[model samples]
Target: MKRRHFLQLTGATLAAVSLVQTARAAQPPATDAKAFRAMRKYANLSFGRIAYVDRGTGDAALFLHGAPLNSFQWRGAIDLLSPYRRCIAPDFMGLGYSEVPEHQALDARAQLEMLVALLDSLGIRAVDIVASDSGGAVAQLFVAHYPKRVRTLLLTNCDVEPNSPPPGIKPILDMARAGTLADMTAEWLTDRAKARATFGAAVFVNPAQLTDEIIDYYVQPLVSSPLRRSQYERYHLALTPNPLAGIESRLAHSTVPVRIVWGGSDTLFPQTDAAYLDRIFPRSQGVHVIPEAKLFFQEEYPSVIAAEARRVWGMR
Candidate 1:
């Protein structure tokens, strides 16, 4: 049998992690590469121009993506939930098509400020948020710093107060500090098979999901120039000093409804974080743990994200 989808409070954390792994078919979900490209628009904020997709209309739902990834990660969720909310997915500066000054500070705090500026540019007052990976760290900071601007939060596999930048990421961080991560990934451009293999092990549950087109879409711009490569390295280095530190009290005090949908099998973030997140936030709905999903499972399981998001927002 396939993994039975489940959601429960932090109380049943152990049982939830013990659930059987899901069977993931190998086909990458069909993404309209052309449509996503055509829809891209830039918001000229104080920092720089941020590339984002603003779709549908209603209360806004801001989707924040992870490191080594950009707004493109949320395409599926936007596709599924846009009709119910104004889905806004922005590529963090230094990632995706977003352009920032070469001297821009690339850190969670910087990202939080950029978000404020982005929302200001759009004349938005508040947002319902869905964030993954490093983006989750930024989301937490956003809540602590600007609690009034958020309505609800949905977090996928990512950093938490106690486990920010999970230990497994050390190697990548080391590579980034050595100024070699971008160069290492640049090889993916010539070796699509290698790209799929690396991402399959790290992010995707199904290797076949990474097609050549997806590889090109994700990697080309990342290493297209020396500046982008430097920014890529800087992006990873900014996670240090534990950005989520000192915000535990603020997060604990927040009234924003929070939900954690984590990938139990993700090597970078431990399964316990789902419970930690559940325990930290007073308004936590629960933690939904997918045993077989990897770090970037939102790309693999957008429906799960959409359902949890709708549930949080009370969408029909």
Candidate 2:
């Protein structure tokens, strides 16, 4: 079946399930602020002092953030999952407090190698990876090349196929490739409102959570450092056709258990891509779509995502 048609059917099925559960609905608990604060820390890795926080203990669970943002993106979800498993949220090179490299090697292979080296330096042999946005592509490369190192995989709202990127993304990719960092930032990156809307529109199942404070947290790192724009440009340039093509094919042959969690409201990649991914891994379970959520579903519906991760890891 076509991906769009599959998603439409899935949406209808989920809506029906929601109706059944409506009668028993109850309010979710408030997020724990103290726990969130406690989980915030930094780690020094090989490439640079890539900042990361490791909370709780037992199996290792690495949370890889998307473009523009860093480990801070996983704060809320880390709080929930930390109680049951060791959760590590690392700022990708050039993002967050991580030191930006002098050289321009931010592509998938370089980033994947950095991750592997970081894990080895930390003495961790294997981990369950939860990656979103650009990080999803990084995770795919890591698993494909180092399959035994990845215990499980969770991908959200990221596309590996060059032919299947969402409509407007191609233009942005082209812009990032051709333009200077200053031009890209002035023309696209620094707009606080646009950033909020772009990110909020992509991941949050609840639009109401796109508060000014949340937006500021996301935008702060980008603006705080002068290098942010250049770093982003280098990262974009690193995304070559070769690595992506290889990762796409490897995903089909992967033996590692995989789960796809998406926000139904995501217009960036669209929930339709979920079907394309499902076909690649037929043994993988069906995609789980959080209704009101957008691309950043992990931020908007962390508890739901946390629960799903626990299920995949067999922790609870």
Per-prediction tally of clashes: 0, 9
Candidate 1 lDDT over 104-155, as tens digits, reads 9999999999999999889899999999999999999999999999999999
Cα lDDT of candidate 1 equals 0.84
Candidate 2 Cα RMSD after full superposition onto the native fold (Å): 4.5
lDDT for model 2: 0.67
Look at candidate 1 and give me any clashing residue pairs. none
For each candidate, the alpha-carbon lDDT, in order, equals 0.84, 0.67
Off by over 4 Å in 1: 1-30
Across residues 283-304, which tens digit of lDDT does each residue of candidate 2 receive? 4545776666666767655666
Please give the distance, in angstroms, between residue 103's alpha carbon in candidate 2 and its true position after superposition: 1.2
